[model samples]
Target chain A: MSASDVTRAIRRMAHEILERNFGCVDVVIVGLQTGGVGLAERLVDDINEIEGTEVPLGSLDATMHRDDFDLRPITSEAATTIPVDPTGKIIVLVDDVLYTGRTVRAALDAIHSYGRPKAIQLAVMVDRGHRELPIRPDFVGKNLPTRRAEMVDVNNDGVDLGEIS
Target chain B: MKALRHLLSMDDLDRDDIEYLLDLTERYVEVSERKIPRIPALRGKTVALVFFEDSTRTRVSFATAAGRLSADTLGFDVGRSSVNKGESLRDTIETISAMGIHCIVLRHFGAGAPWRVREWTDASIVNGGDGRNQHPTQSLADLFTARQHLGDLDGRRIAIVGDIKNSRVARSNAIGFSKMGAEVIFVAPRTLLPASLEGWPVKVTHNLDEVIESIDVCYLLRMQLERQNDAAVPTLREFHHEFGLTTARADRLRDDALIMHPGPMNRDVEIAGVVADRPNAVITEQVSNGVAVRMAVLFVLIGSRLDLVEEQSAVA
Candidate 1:
């Protein structure tokens, strides 16, 4: 996927969030660390343009709460920023790829560590259908049928594509 | 899912269990000196950390040990979660267990809280710490340190001083020390020692100077200001005068005798600064051994699929 394709998909996912939520007042878009935060910021910008109002944006480092942290050392250097009150405000959790849903699980746990959000909805760039959990993305940009061994890399800044090793 | 196998509390660990963990720790301490110090035992396994209290040392050490063995780690702090919103501890643990977490490392401020968590979760539990009742890991590390110094635990005189009744360190150390064939003497004021000592296999004394002179190993426990339940708590100055291991007290011990503390020391309250930093002091060694001991504990409890590592060791 090209950078243009990535932007278009995020814009689409942002619109779906607005349409489903019936507007998004006091709504905050929080991206999971590294690549997800970049995409989340872009989505927040796109959503602001569509609604003709500023939408808050945030980023999170799920390093401390990562399941694979003990297996794989934390590499992300991104900082967390939650601008809106998580309590009673709608939180749109953004991530690059939804695989076995473990990263999402860690991200949710990390977000809760920061503050309590009244409601949290997950949005992802790629819905690689091998979810180990019962979770499904609330706003999915594209559903790519992926094998168990394949890894998806969504460059929220440059190219967005699922690469099979 | 065996409830007893879960190490959510000190009560879960009896004499044999402690011995097994100690034996495993000895093996791992040796294995850590190899060229590549890691095992593949916990591969594809996950250990969740539900830390209600913040701990830098324990968290990092456990994470590093787990990573060396290729196990996944899930850690969460409680402040931002439903835990802060009045969610029951059992409910939180049950939710994580449902996610297929294989093991849990929990630390709480209330005694027996981990037991409550065990009631709701099937994951094998390692009690990082819970209230003032116990910090088994610290004691395990302490035992490892003692074994390293004395070469053996048999016929060793281990003296534990200060905040005897209030300190989980003292409690766990007394049990572990005595179990390992060391004669442990609890040195503290009558007010400090628990009123009832029916089952403890240790001698009680109020004379720090006399006990300090006799022991081969002097383990000083910090006098916890946090645990002082009353405003009439003894002043640090008066406490030190009575029980602190001053330089004068250190001189009373044999030349080869070892001194140790669990860290975050109070200087003169339970131990003197120089004594804690003395050449005989193994406090730093204790901290370093903490990682190795925890590595062994995590490996054994979690079963990190480490047949390859042991096979490699055999060939070496």
Candidate 2:
């Protein structure tokens, strides 16, 4: 996937979100920390550009809520800023890549500490299939099936699938 | 990055580690600001608060930090525990570790208790003031509070006043501040000052009034009356008159200079009542930051272990 591919995917995702949510009323977009933050911000901008209406933006860090905490390196924490009350609001969780589905699960657990939202919807720039858990993204930009050893890198340059080595 | 297993002393951390922990503390500070001031960081993890000494602030601070992180905290009651039955410290620590405790926040009258406990158990040891050895977390909180008011610690002049010989807070703060590039000045009467400033990287002074004008922070240490001998001071009145942070001395300090104390303060003895409660006084903020700092420490130790375990399992 190229940079233009990512841009087009983001625009499509934004339009899909607006169309499905029925014009963005009470809709909130939250980017996962680190990778998802930039993508979420861009998605919010795209949504605003398309609808000419403002939507609430937030960033959630799922480091502490991770299930694989005891097996990995110490995860660095990022700021979780939910500017508006998530209660009774539609929460659209945005992320860069959906791999193990563990991170999204962690994000779901982390969000409860904030407030119980009416609904939470997951949006990913790319869904590389190799899930260890029974989790799925509500909105996916691209669904790329890959081996377990493969890595997906998503950024301004767009998404690249390559071997870990 | 390499994970810190035990925080036995301020010496165990470098400038980078201190800065990292302080930065990590900002996240917890944000968590604390939320309507629900709790996180699932340490959920399902157990932490033991093993205090052989009586401490209201540090003990409560660690407990609150663990609770906010959602960790199960077991406050070891030295009063009722097997210590009363003459069980050894080593045995007690091993027994607790055997029960699957993840971390131990220890406070003991004997210096190096945490360091020794580390040899006995794999549980990460956090020194919550070991005798007169070191209170690394208190220093971390002090640094956090100082940074809150003073902005940056680099080249900041900090005068650690009062009982230097018996103050673990002073010892830890001296090492921590200097490591962070702060100029540390030890202020005390001749008797109260350490016999030798030999190895420590700090300027020793007998007069607080002279340096009060130049200092960025007047960090007053409690005059440990219980630890002091008759020769340590002529009298409490004379000590307060000469070395204490009296109103007159406080008047000489810079307007922006911060007044700090590791409580509970002996109001009239080490610092004037008015000085302690003044707007520039950040003693309360230090107490509040204490929880955040400890939470950061706990997360780094226990959280890292959890991560490492999961990583190994994934590899397997």
Candidate 3:
């Protein structure tokens, strides 16, 4: 996927989110740290520009809520910051890629700690299916099917599918 | 993540290590503020609290930190345990290690007990408080609290006032603050001052008035009623007049100067009761930050994955 394709997908996703939610009432956009932060910012910016309404933006690092901590170290470099209380609000969780579904699951666990949201919808730039958990994204930028051993890279440049080694 | 086998002293950490741990401490602080203030960072790991001495805050703090990380904590009570039956420290440590624990948070009246215990157990050893030696986590908490109020401790002035000779907090914090580029000043009477200050990176002053108004932090040490038996001063009243953060002395402090105490404070002896209630006094914050700091320390030291850079020995 090219940079222009990623921007176009974000613009379309912003439109779909408003249309699905029926006019974007009490909508809060939270981007996962590192990868999804830029995408979420762009998504919120596009949504606000299109709807002519301001939306709250926040970022979360779901490292602490990870279920496989017994298998890896907890790196808490980036802090989780939610500007407003999420109680009874529609939270649009944005991420760069949807793979394994573990990160999204951990992010769900993390968001519940702050407050009970009215609902949560997942947005992803790329959906590379290899889910170990029953989780799905509500919005997707690109659908790239690959082998289990392949790696999907998402950045400002583009999305590249390649082997890690 | 930094590989650490044992956290025995403030000397074990460098400037970068302290900053890394304190930065992680900030993240833990955020975790603690949520509706559910617990995380499963160290699930299935066991942290044994092998405290050979009596304590209130340090013991509770470490146990709470381990629990927040979803690790099991087994507190070995000295009074009720085999210590009464004359079992050796080594024997106690071996017994705990045989059960396969991940860490041991120890507080013993003997100064070098954690080092000796580290030899007995494969688990990481954390010095909760080892005699008059060092309380690394307490100092870490102090640094974290200081950083919360002040940005970086690069040029801050800290006046550790009280019985410096008997304070593990003072000893550890002097090294810690200095490592962070803070100037440390020890204020105490002649009898309460340590015998040697040649190796320490601090300036010694017998009078609190000399640096009271100039310091960025006024750290008051709890009068060690149990440890100070040397007739350090004429009376408690005299000590209060001379060095205690009396209302007058508190008023003399800089408006932004932070007043701190390690805990179980002697309200009238070291710090006045009214003065402690002042906004500048972050005594409560110090105590609360203790949990977060210990959480960061424990998670960084032992809760790391097996594939990371695993190294032995502390006090680098």
Candidate 4:
């Protein structure tokens, strides 16, 4: 996708989120570490612009809760920061790309330890097919499918599809 | 940089390694603060506790860290093994290695024993404490806890007082704190200090009174009760009078100055009982951070390389 397209999607997603949730009084926007942080921040900015009210923002890294820990080594990519208890609040989990859905699974496990959220909805900039787990994104910017080994990298500039050298 | 296969000493970690481990400890600290206080980071892994000395906080801290990460622990009963059956350290290590453990947290009465254990086993070795050599995790805990209260340790003055010669905590903290840009001062009776501070990166003083008010962190070390018999001090009372954190000395400290001790403390000999009750005393927080630091160390050791198990198997 192009830069304008990405921006437009984020803006529209923000409006859709506000309309569905009825103004975000109980909403917490949690972005996945590294990849989703910038996107989440942008979404929160858009939401704030629309509602004139700030939503609690947090970033989470799910390396600790990953099921593939034994098969592959993992490192904590970033710090998890939730400003308030997520109990009884709607958690809008954001990620840059939704592929295997394993990270989302791990993130679900990690979030449970904090507090049981009233509900969790996944938001992704791109939803590429090839899911190994039963997980789906509630909000999407784009849908692009490719071979398993191909890489999908999303940034503020745009989305790039390429091989990882 | 390649991640460490063994956390054997403070010397094994450079500034980047120390910074990474401590930063990672912050995340574990957050996990600890959560309602569940647990994670599955080290799931399907096992860490063997191979302690050859008496311990309380360090042992319990390691066990708790492992449990929070969902790692299983196999504790070697030191009481039944070498002391009774006369099996050597070599014999015990080999036995644990044969059981296919992933990591070993070793505490021994002899210095550099963890290095020898590293040679005997492919499982990663963490120097829980080996004599007066090093206790890197405890140092990490100290750094984490101190940073929590006082922010960055950079340019901060820390007075590590009492039993300097016999303390592994002193050795580790001296290196660990100095590495983080803190100015470290070693205070003790001359006899309790190592014969020379020739190459040590710290200031040495026989007086705590001079620096007490000026220092940012007053770190008290336990006065090993056995030291009195060894004639290091004429009496426990003299140690208290001279170097201890008595009410008078405690009163001399800056109100915001931090008080830290790596625990199993000598209540009256090193730190006064009432002084420990004060708000600035962060000895309890040190114990709490100890578990988080240990969890970070374990996560670093176990999850450092994704193909570690494969590499180990291929090598074997």
Candidate 5:
């Protein structure tokens, strides 16, 4: 995927989000920590451009809610900032890629501690097919079939696929 | 980077480590400010608070920190537990670790208790307050509090007054402050001073009034009457007259100087009652910062290690 392809995908996703939520009212965007933060910010900018209004934006760190916490080494945590009340609002969780669906699950658990939202929807830049959990993205920029050993790198430049080796 | 397994002393951490923990503490402080001041950082993990010595602040702070991180806290009761049945410290620690605890916050009457416990358990050990040896977390919180009030600790003058010989807080704070580029001065009577400041990087002074003007932080350590004998001080009144932070002495201190005490203060003895309540006093802030600092320590020791591993695997 090229830079133009990424931009076109984001524009389409932004339009779909605005259409589904009827002009983005009561809709808040939360980007997952690290990779998803940039995408979430971009989405918020795109949505504001279309709707002529600002959407509540936040960044979530799901490290604490991960199931394999004890099985893996510890990592430095990023900040989780929700500037607005998530209760009675629609939470749109944004991430760079969708792989095992475990991260989305963790995000779901994490958001509960903040406040109970009316609904939560997942948005991803790339939907790589290999989900361990029964999770699906509400807005997908690209559906890229991937092998378990392959890695997907998504950034402003584009999305690139590489093998683990 | 790999996370630390145990915090035996301030020596285990460099300036970077201290700064990292302090920076991480800011995030925890933010978490504390939230409507729900709890995080799932340590969910499904268990921490044991083993206090062989009686404590009110350190013990409660560690427990509260663990709870705030969503970790189950197991309080080891030395009064009613098998410890009273003459069970060895090693055995007690091993028993706790055998129960599948993830971390141990240890406070023992013996110095180096946490270090010795490290040998018996694979679980990470955080030193709460060991016998006149080191209280690394307390120093971390103290540094955090000092930095909050004094801005930067670099080139800051801190005088740790009273009971230097039997203060784990003093030992830890001296190392921590020096590591962070602060100059430490020990102000106490000769009998209260340690016999040797040979390798210790701090100055010694017998006069409180002489150094009060130049110091940025006057950190007062509790006079452990239980730990001292008659030889340590001639009389309480004489000690108060000579080295105590009396109201008159406090008046002589610089307006910007901070008055700090590691609590349960002997009122009008080491510090005047009114002085502790002054605006320059950050004693309460230090207590609150203790929880944040401990939360940072536990998070790094247990949760951050996973992050390191993930980064390494990604690089591989």
Candidate 6:
């Protein structure tokens, strides 16, 4: 996948979010740290281009709030930027890849702690087939079937591809 | 093999883990007091100190401690690191981890920053100091100093003086002392005490004189000037006048009682010079013990079997 693919995904995701959640004029696109944050910003830009209005961009680090807190180590404190009011506003959670659905769950828990959002929608670049929880991405760029043993890394910067064995 | 997995927060460690670390420090303390003080525990290990925030004492002490344990130390000032160029903290950890670093001592300016680093790697990441969050080693050093002077922290009165609201050291110490069965009295101006203190299982006091003499150990905390952005305290002079440990106040304490500071002491601001230098003072001792405590922490988190380190290294 080239950089153009990632760009196209963002553009498509932004349109879907605006069309489905039509009544929600105030929308916040919150990225989950790393790759998700960059994607969220790009999506927000795309959303602005499509709707002819600005959307807020926020970033969150779900390390501490993760259920697998003990399974792995803690991460460096990422700057959590919630630019717009979450109360009664639509929160669209963005990530590079949606695999186990744990990151989204953690992000949702973290967001509630800051403020109450009217609703939340998840958008991901790649939706790998296996999901450990009852979660489905509302806007998915591509559905790449992946095995549990393999790892999915999103190169939103240079190329967009899932690395698997 | 590796030195430490990480020191996220003190709460991450259980009671036995804390004791194991203390016991390790005890052995190192004996070594330091001996004619020759050197250990090969970290002989071939490399400790990388990545501090994104300004920390004079924590950075220096950790480096000195790592050196004493025979570990090669590399200190990275964030002002010069790739972080200044907008490289995320996680990427920086990954970059250092790839360098075959045995341990990473990180002092980040954000609260829970170390925990954040912990998520990124399996290497032992020590929290040099996090922003108004938890400074586990400082508390460990404080506890070590208190125990060294007072024999045991159990049932002893420990008055944590000054800047409770913004001092992670004080917060960690309060919890640590309490866990050790010591009565922790948080002595500070009403403005400086954390609102969370009410939830803490300890007595809080605004008047220093009320709890000062009753305590076996007076733990002086340096005023966190960084909290100046929040105006955490109204005035430094007023804080000193009301809560600072003066020479006159020192006269009232038991002779055997200890005066401890986690240093880079605020000197005239937090503690009087005479008391700070007094025979009962364990300020310097804390610095020395910091290494031992850190060594123990590194030892446990990395692996108890140092022999296996060679095998692990060969495999890597």
Per-residue C-alpha lDDT of model 5 across residues B48-130, encoded as one tens digit per residue: 99999999999999999999999999999799799888999989998999999999999998998888889999999999889
TM-score of chain A of each: 0.88, 0.97, 0.97, 0.96, 0.98, 0.90
Summarize candidate 2's per-residue lDDT along B1-316 as a digit string, tens digits. 3467889899999998888889889889988876788878888999999989888999999999999999999999799899999999999999999999999999999998887899999888999999888999999999989988888899999999999999999999999999999999999988877677789989998988779899999999999988876678888898899989999999888999999999999999999998898899999999999999999999988875645645666788
- Tell me the tens digit of each residue's lDDT in model 6 across B105-200: 888879988877888876778888888888998888877777777776779998989988888888788778887779988888777877665568
lDDT of candidate 4 vs native? 0.89
Better of 1 and 4 by DockQ: 4
lDDT digits (tens) for residues B11-130 of candidate 1: 456666666667666655644553445545567889888888767878877887787666899987897789888888888888889999988999888877877787787788888888
Query: What DockQ values do the models have?
Result: 0.01, 0.52, 0.60, 0.56, 0.37, 0.01
Ranking by DockQ: 3, 4, 2, 5, 1, 6
Ten-residue segment with the worst summed lDDT in candidate 5 chain B?
A: B302-311
What's model 6's TM-score? 0.61
TM-score for each of the candidates: 0.61, 0.93, 0.95, 0.92, 0.89, 0.61
Residue-level error in angstroms, candidate 3, position B254: 1.2
Give Cα-based local distance difference scores for all models: 0.77, 0.90, 0.90, 0.89, 0.90, 0.76
Model 3 lDDT on a 0 to 1 scale: 0.90
TM-score of the A chain in model 5: 0.98
- Against the true structure, whose DockQ is highest? 3
**Global Cα RMSD, each model:** 16.3, 2.7, 2.8, 3.1, 3.0, 21.6
Better of 1 and 3 by TM-score: 3
lDDT of 2 at B164: 93
Which 10 residues in a row give candidate 3 chain B its minimum summed lDDT?
Answer: B307-316
- Model 5, span A1-165: residue lDDT tens: 998999999999999999988889899999999899999999999999998999999999887678877677644578989988788999999999999998899999878877889999999999998899999999999999999999999999999999997
| TM-score, chain B, each candidate | 0.88, 0.95, 0.96, 0.94, 0.97, 0.89
Q: What tens digits encode model 4's per-residue C-alpha lDDT throughout B67-92?
A: 99889999886986764687778888
Docking class of 6: incorrect
